[model samples]
Target: MIEILNPTLLTRAAGTGALVADILHTLKGRSTAGTNLLDIDRWAKAMITEAGALSCYVDYAPSFGRGPFGHYICTAVNDAVLHGRPRDYALADGDLLTLDLAVSKGGVAADAAVSFLVGDGEHPESVAMINATERALAAGIAAAKPGARIGDLSHAIGTVLSEAGYAVNTQFGGHGIGSTMHQDPHVANTGRPGRGYELRPGLLLALEPWVMADTAELVTDADGWTLRSATGCRTAHSEHTIAITADGADILTLPKHMRP
Candidate 1:
């Protein structure tokens, strides 16, 4: 479903976006070398409850995943990339961790994700992969405008990933989000420009650019939710929820501490 948020609802969306961003930032800060993925999930639940927000994931049952995600946040580590279900694994030094989160406040929802290293180990390959995704995400956001097409954003993101020498996977990518975690107008990481839906004011999009170091293929783990690189290569993901406006795009999911 493609939703164009009214002004009031857009305001609510900004709040939800801030909440999701703050939660992810907090979780990333708390995720140390010995922190367990399950503990991170518990922390997310507590924070969401305290903020009086509803989780868009915990009870989520989608076609690609098993019923009832049963986790407050996605804890993708190293080789894992998307829809990573929180489990009993403890984080290790230099483990590339991706935390994806979505939540609703005041009836509007926002989604975002961030990838970062777990501890004080400087894994050059992991750092480079994470940086590439971040750059791709920035390019995608910069390409968003009122008159732009979805393909423009995708192309911008894809360009960055391809130039960084990483393979792109289109099976699951960014999508329209508004009152729900995932919605219409599937935004692939790569696409031709001047194609797909045209942007309009009030439209909300979650632009995510993710990539695997070596291959574009994905393999689901035994948990039935976590998606890992088919070649066991490390992966990275970056995302932000933005609202289309007359001037340009308003990135709503930046953490309070990160806002200018």
Candidate 2:
């Protein structure tokens, strides 16, 4: 489904985006060396409850996953990239961690993710990969405007990753998000420009740009959720929920303190 928030509903969506961004910001701050993945999930759950919002992940049971996600946040560490189910593991210094969260408030949903090194990891390759994803995400957002095609966003994102020496994976990418969570207009990380759905005012899209260092192939962990690089190469992901407007694309999922 392609959801276009009406003026009144868009107001509610703005709140949902703020909540998602706030929770992600808080969780990122708390994640560090020796931090348990479960603890991060707990922190997110508490914050969501305190805000009177609902978690889009807690009961997310898509056919691709084992069962209901049962977690408040996705903690993808190092090799792990997508659908990372929280487990009994403590983060160590130099570990690359990705925190993805989605929440609904006032009947609207927002999703976002960030990847960063746990402690001070000065590995050049790792740092480069992280930076590339962030750059790609920015490019995608820049291409998302009224009358823009999904392919334009995809092409913009792909250019960054490809130029940075990383391989793009298309198995899972961004999607339309609204009141119920995932929606239509699948946004791939790489594609031809001037194609796919045309952007329109009031449309909400979650543009995520993720890349694996060496291979585009991925292997699902035994857990049936966590996706890891086939070559165990490092990975990074960056995402944001944006809404189309007459003015341009408004990035709704920016943290309150970081808003423009």
TM-score of 2: 0.98
- Clashes (backbone N, CA, C under 3 Å), per candidate, total 0, 0
By summed lDDT, the worst window of 10 consecutive residues in model 2 runs over 119-128
Clashes of 2: 0
lDDT of 1 by residue, 1-260 (tens): 89999999999999999999999989989999999999999999999999999999888999888778988899999999999999989999989999999998998899999999988998999899889999999999899998899999999999999999987889989999998889998999999999999999999999999999899999999888999999899999999999999978999999998877
Off by over 4 Å in 1: none
lDDT of 1 at 137: 92
Candidate 2 C-alpha error for residue 177, in Å? 0.8
Relative to the unseen true structure, what is the C-alpha lDDT of residue 178 in candidate 1, on a scale of 0 to 100?
Answer: 90
Candidate maximizing lDDT: 1
For candidate 1, which ten residues in a row score worst on lDDT? 63-72
